[model samples]
Each structure stands twice: as C-alpha cells, then as structure tokens.
Target: MDRISDFILPAVIICIVGYGFIKKAPVFDLFLEGAKEGLCTSVQILPALVALMTAVGMIKASGALDSFTYALRPVAALLHLPQEVLPLALLRPISGSGALVIFQDILRQYGPDSLIGRIASVMQGSTETTFYTIAVYYGATKVQKTRHTLPAALTADLVGFLMSALAVRLLLP
Candidate 1:
C-alpha cells in the first residue's frame, strides 16, 4: 500500500505523457515549458527555504527549545502524558518537519501504544508547518510586514497541539 502511493503519481504522469505523445498532442512543448517553470520555482523558493532553516537552527541552538520542553514536563505529568512528549510539544510549534521526524522516532520507540506515541501521531496529523505557512503567505502577497506574525503562528501551533491531544483523548480511548 505504501509503495503504491510512491508509484501512483509518477505512474499517472507517465501515462499522461505517453498518451500525449501517441496522440501527437502539443504536450511535449508544454511539458518542457512546465519543467522550466518548475526550475524557476525551485530557484524562487530557495530564499524562503534557507530562511526557514536558519530560523529553526537558531531556535534549536539557543536554549529556548530546551526551556520550552522543560516547562512542558509538569503539564505532561498533570495530564498523565508520557514524558517523551514534552520535547515533542516544543518541537511541534516551531518546526513542522522536525516535529514529524521526532514523531516517527517516538512511534518507533513506543510502538504506538505508549501515550506519547499516540499523542505524537495526533500532533503530527493536526499541526501545520508554521514557517511554511508564513513563507507561502508572504511569498504570494506584496505585504512587506505583518504585526504579531510570530506570536500568532506560535499560538496557532500551540492550540493545535493541545486540541490534537484533547481530541484524541475524547475520541480515541
């Protein structure tokens, strides 16, 4: 099933290309042009990608992420959450890819039965990538700056993490 997903989109694209070629459709030129546009897109996105990575690196290098995890420990205890999830809570808000990586690590460690495993899965499912959102929003628009950008994004991610856990508890046993 998983491999099917890996193959599906490429398979479809190949089919489309083959059909276009057989039918003598104008798709070859269009495809080449599309490929050029995609290269342009990759170039355009490099700045945002670099910026997001740098920000994530700085956050991790500073003690803030550790402090945030430490702060979450008490709440985790009160909620009977597995201690492992404390670091996840901190990661979930700031970096989406990092959180997903950590989520997979928790899943591997606890085999999905552990409280942290289930919660990490839920958090990974529910949360959006904050920097990705900001980048896309800013990239598409002409806005130079926005007020409360960091605070709003962090708040959304925080609320999403809480709700993911709460929803799992209420809905999933």
Candidate 2:
C-alpha cells in the first residue's frame, strides 16, 4: 500500500506540473474564452430551442406521428423487431423531444423489463440528438441545400437503432 501510494502521489504530482507548465497562460485564457462563448451561445440558441419545441409540439399534436408509426409496422415485423420500438426508430433522428415521447411510449407499452424497452433506453443513451447535430452543423457551416443530408444522417441513426437492439439482447438479461 505504501509503495502504491508513493508511486501514485508522484505520478499525480508530475502530471499536474507537466500540464500546468506546458499549457500555462493559454489554457486559462482558453477556458475563460470557452465559458464566455458558451454563455453567449446559450442566449443565441434560445430562439432555436423555442422554435424546435413548438414545431415538435405541433407535430405531436397532429395525428401524423400515429400514422408514421403505423407505416413502419410492416418493416418492424419483417425485421422481427418489437412493435414498441418502431416509434422510437422513426422519432430518434428527427427531434429529441419527439424521440423522448416515443421512448416513453415504448416504456409504457413494453414495460421497463421488456426487451424492447431496454433496447429503446439503450438506444437513447448511445445515440446523439440528431436534430441538434444537423442544426449545429448547418448553423456553423451555413449550408442551406439540405440535400443528401437526411439519408446520410439516417444511415447512422438506423445503425444506432439496430446496434442498441442487438446490444441489449446480447448483453442484458
């Protein structure tokens, strides 16, 4: 234990000193600059957050989500997937709130202990917020075309969806 403590204490001290000396002034300034940018960024994104939430609310208010889920039933059946997971797949790549709603619906329909519910929960954890990704990328790059973006994004989204299901089945009881 004493040997372990001696080695660990010196290693920690060396790492701290190394980083402090190497980084120096730039690191502190960078951290402060990042914090300031993040603050301004939060304010800038407020409008976007409202718009996204309102749009998602309207979409959910409409009956479109039900039909969308229904349309995917055949595909899910063919894939031997649980019906409970269909809504999550459809919503996951579009909007975070929409995806959460679908995730909650899956939990409600399948129960938390069920395979589909576990898979949906895992899917939520593993994947990023897709709409947020596109928004950030487009916002930063100012690309307006939106051509080929959906398909490319969907490819990754689908993989995340399938991977979550497979992972839950393979890993969880």
Candidate 3:
C-alpha cells in the first residue's frame, strides 16, 4: 500500500504531462500561468488573512476567549457538553490553529480516552475555521456583500459542536 501510494502522485503527473503532449498543449506555460494566478490570489487575500489573524491574536491576548468560554459554561452544561471543551468549540470557527491549541490542551488535561477528549477530537474534524475561510475565499474573490454566509456558517459550526458531543455520548460504552 505504501509503495503504491508513493507512485500515485508521480503516475498522475506523468499521465497529465503525457496527455498534454498528445494534445499539443503548452503544459509548462499553462502550469506557469496557473502558478501566477494562484500567486495573485494569495496577494489579494493577504490583507484579509492578516486582519483575521491579528484579530484572533488580540482576542486571545486580551483574555476575551476565556471570558466568553466562562460565560458559555451554563449553556454548555444545558447541552450536556463538557465545560472543558467550551473554549475549543468557541475557538474552532474563528481560528483553526487557535482551536488546535485548545484541542491539544483538552487532550493533555483529560487524556484522549476521556469523554471531553473524544468530543474535542470529533469537533476538530467536523467543524471549520469559518471566519478565516470567509476572509480568504471572499477576499480572494472580492465578494462585498456576504449576506447570509456568516450566519449560515456559524449555524453549521454550532451543529458540528453539539453533534460532536452527542455522537460521542451515543457511541461510548
């Protein structure tokens, strides 16, 4: 399996180049053009990405995240979520790396076999960094009026968080 996987990418690349040659396509020029466009897209989104990262850093540094997690404890309890995982849930939508740090802390504090660890692991897989995604993709595309995107993405994140806890509970012995 490992040997086959190692050749998979090379095989695909070889097939693509072969097909391009057979079709008389400028494969190298096309590749360069695609790379240039990707670079332009990265440049276009850089401001939004920087702004989002700065905002996340500020929120974390100001202790606002912890305060918000504390405020959400009652709601979490009502939903039968472990209070320890509240920070991970709250941070998951804003910053993937930040949520990852919180997730790691959860695993370290509770161990991977524990309920909190399981739920956190599930959430890490299920949810997304909504704000970061919106910032990059919308910024790259120059989308001005994101009328329903934010709310819809947030709703999905909430479902992911809740479902992560519920699924773990159901599957546990």
RMSD of each: 3.4, 6.6, 2.5
lDDT agreement of model 1 with the native: 0.78
All candidates' lDDT scores?
Answer: 0.78, 0.77, 0.91
Q: Answer with 2 or 3, whichever has the higher TM-score.
A: 3
Name the candidate that leads on TM-score.
3
Clashes of each: 0, 0, 0
User: Tens digits of per-residue lDDT for model 3 on 1-173?
Assistant: 99999999999999998999899999999999999999888899999999989988898799998899889989999999999998898889988888888889989999998988899999999888999999988988767999999999999999999999999989884
| Candidate order by decreasing lDDT | 3, 1, 2
lDDT of 3: 0.91
Off by over 4 Å in 2: 1-23, 26-30, 39-51
* TM-score, every prediction: 0.74, 0.69, 0.88
Q: What TM-score, to 2 decimals, does candidate 1 have?
A: 0.74
